[model samples]
Target: MKGIVMEVYEDKVIVLAKDGSFLEVNRDNRDLDIGQEIEVDDNNKKIRGRIIKRLASIAAAFILLITTGYGVYGYYTPYGYINVDINPSVEIAYNLYNRVIDLKGLNEDGNILISKIKNYRNRTIENVINEVIDTAVEQAYVRPEQENVILITITEKKDKVDDEKIYKLVDSHIKQKIENTEVILIEGDNNIYKRAREDKISPGKLMLIEKAIDLNKDIKFEEVAKKPVKEIMRMIKEAKREKEKKEERKKLEKKTEKEMDKIEEMKFNKSRKAKGKKEDKLEREEIEKFRKDKTKKDEEEKEIEVDKIEKYKEKDQRRYLKKKSQDEFEEQRKEKQENLIINDNKKNQDNKYKVDKSEKKNKSKRGHENEYKHNKKERGKDED
Candidate 1:
């Protein structure tokens, strides 16, 4: 049956079928993504029944191919491949049923290790891997006292299986069976596997070499390709550490630069405030000086005005005294003149009175004589 992959998990894929039904199928190294179309076995039967049917079909195909004289070739045909690298490089091929079909050595140490394994064919892939590790341990290829690294790279001929399950099974088995060994698992495509084979190296080693070269561009592939897996991994680890340290240093430098910039800004603002204060002080001093000068000028003007008033008062007093003295002298001269006139007039009148008195006395004397003569004549006449 065909369906669209709706969701994918480590060991199962949720597929949406055309009949609007959902099916959960076991994922065995199948590289599936959401929305991709895939062929799945019918879900009507139980998973055990399906496996039995599949096995029956294989058996029938095997019998048919045996009658055709091509049974061994068809049974040994690989559906997936795994490359194990420790210093020794070994490759294992498995058929559709996940049974090991072949094993090959890529180097001298790998050849020696494989020669020690008595029987690997027709065994489960996990059992085959266990035996291979056991053989390597027996040959001292994997020493517990030293830093042992095993790099496993898996590549499928078709997208019908989940490599993650296989990697987990192998990882769990090796960890239980071995100690003090680092196991690295890699899931690769046909292109990378083919390229690694062409370069005469395992895919896991090639991947490490590529990563190392990316970290340090000065490293050459040929120079590092011949090195052991442990040494290449060590180089990769040191390079990563150096990269991290450099990043941290750059961050610290940036932080220091920012702090310095902040300090400089504060200093600039402080200096600006100080300069402003100095200008303010100078301005205040100028204002105070102007006030003092104005005060002094006003005092000097008042003193000059007072002196002018005093000088005017003195001139007025002198003029008043001179005028009074002149008036007094004129009055005294006029009084003396009046007194002399009165005295002259009195003298003249006194002289006139004396003359009149003398004349009057003479007249009186003549009149009395005349009266007496007349009386005497009258008396004589009477006597006669």
Candidate 2:
């Protein structure tokens, strides 16, 4: 079977022959899609499948060593001669496309539209040529999962994806593929002058981080949106900075509110003390007036007792009543006068104390208000 292959696990082995209708023989893996014959020891101890090995076999010589048709006949195939070098199957496909489409003629307007279409078809599969180059490279470094190199040629003039957008798209999608295989890219044009140099990329182990692009295919942004490592790390740093800033702002606001509350409490305390002092003053004043009225009434009673002494004509009665009046009036008046003086002094002391405390309280309250203002300014500065 020319194209028969059996895949075990992830490796594909070419099935080349059948022995005794039950056992099988196969060409050793070479990673190329083309088929060739190989010779092995009678007991399968020795296997030969390399390029030189194929030269010893007649069947391999027919496929790779000899050319008997109007196909590539030289190692130095020229710029316009790649299609001639391709395998017969691809050659037949190209001929069919040419016959069915007449891709080389011109119209009445002398426009070379057919020529352009032929060019398009040719460039569409240019990577088949690059595959040859990749195989040459892979000879030394046969990548795991078989990394592939494709050569693509673009037409001279036609519609294509935007170049910059294509770069961004491709760089994001091709990062995930078979292990150890990093696909290589190269592009050229009709004169076959290369436009873009080759890019060899390694696959990502975590998530697919390479950009993969498909020409003339529709794909979405998220499907290929892996940010470069540098970009992602930069974003993380920026997020941390923003979070720190927010936390600092909240602290500033909290400190400012705390200071404001302290100032408010000081103001309240100062006003409450001032109000209490006023009430105390009023109460003292009422006490003074009541004491004075009671003292005046007691003096009138003392004068009446003096008249009783004079009206008692007898010496004994006069002496006894005089003694009573003197003792009672003197003692009572002395006590009342002492009480009045003490109460007046107490009122004066209370007023003085209140005045001193009020001054200190007002000063303290003003200091608290100023402190709050300073704190507010500091908080604002911090936020800025």
Candidate 3:
């Protein structure tokens, strides 16, 4: 059946068929737009339809709807298209709600992405596209380490999603995949051509180079792309110099800190040595004082012992002098007594001689005999 689109809404659409019957249909196809013809197919009164883009003749639509006896108009949300061509070429049509309404894999290489794309139906386009690219990377269709070129075509939508938003969405999705893959992005649009004209650079090279610059800010898009390798090397050398300077500064700081620590350690050692020396000096002083005290005490003891010995000698000398005096006096007295006895005997003999000498020779003889006898008696008394 065929119908002319009459009314459109967010979720459904109304179509006026040739039988003058108004039909409502669920909108599931993304390609359907306003002011378009459609063909409805009925299987057991269940209706499904697709928009016919090339069919613009209203009379032909009426004749087809009359013959089929039933017709419906299908509504689909207006959205943009994202065409990704790696080794695999896939077209994804999404709605304003970011839903994947249509998907097509144009080549045999697309099987990797196609198999995974179904899992993201009616999901956000960014999420679904990210999953698809990830799947492609996993399957090695898009090599991760090598230079993989991606061509993105975005159909601009008004009052819904802008060109910038779509471009960023596509770029983010592709970047989220193939972490080690170096990507070269080629944008197909008048915007890329305009930038190319303004920079006086080729559009193809400009877009890819700009993308490279966006990915790595180190590459000055305007400066290094057209310059020789020598200039690029110079730029890299300058960056290396900056990095070296930072490292040198850090090394210098560490060296300074180390030097300070060494100085502090030396000072501590010096202080400890000084303190040890002071302690040693005090110990030496204490030892010297003790020695002095001991020596003084010994000298005092020696002096005391000498004084005691001198007193004992003086007492012994006095005792010996007294004994000698007594012995000398007694000897003197005995000598005198013996002298006196001798003198007395001499006196007595003188007195007796004077009496006897005169009176007789005869009497003298007798007296001589008597004198001898008296001498004998005196000898006996002396002996006794």
List model 2 lDDT by residue over 68-163, tens digit each: 443334211222212111011011012211111112211121122222122122222222333332332334323345433221122223233233
Predicted candidate 3, C-alpha RMSD: 30.4
Better of 1 and 3 by TM-score: 1
Candidate 3: tens digits of C-alpha lDDT, residues 1-384: 775555567776655555645566556753334433555544213223443332324435644543453332111443555666555666677765555667776556665568764334444566556666777777777665665555554543544445566557656766776554333334455676456447654344455565455544677776655642223334555666776898999999999999999999999889778878778799799999999999999999999999999999889889988888988899999989988998899889887776666546668788899999999999999999
Listed per model in order, the count of residue pairs whose N, CA or C atoms clash below 3 Å is 7, 14, 0
Provide the overall lDDT of each model, using Cα atoms, as 2-decimal numbers.
Answer: 0.79, 0.39, 0.61
- Which stretches of model 2 miss by more than 4 angstroms? 1-24, 27-32, 36-65, 72-174, 178-187, 190-384
Best model per TM-score: 1
RMSD (Å) of each candidate, 1 decimal: 26.6, 40.6, 30.4
Candidate 1 residues 1-384, lDDT tens each? 776555679988766565645677787885455544567666532324454455445445534653465555656689888888888899998886676778999888889889887546655677677778777877888886798888888888676556677667766766675678888888888888889989988888899999999999988999998888999999999999999999999999999999999999999889768878778798799999999999999999999999999999999999999999999999999998998999899999999999999999999999999999999999999999
lDDT of 1 at 291: 100
Cα-based lDDT at residue 303, candidate 1: 99
**Ranked candidates, highest lDDT first:** 1, 3, 2
TM-score of each: 0.54, 0.18, 0.29
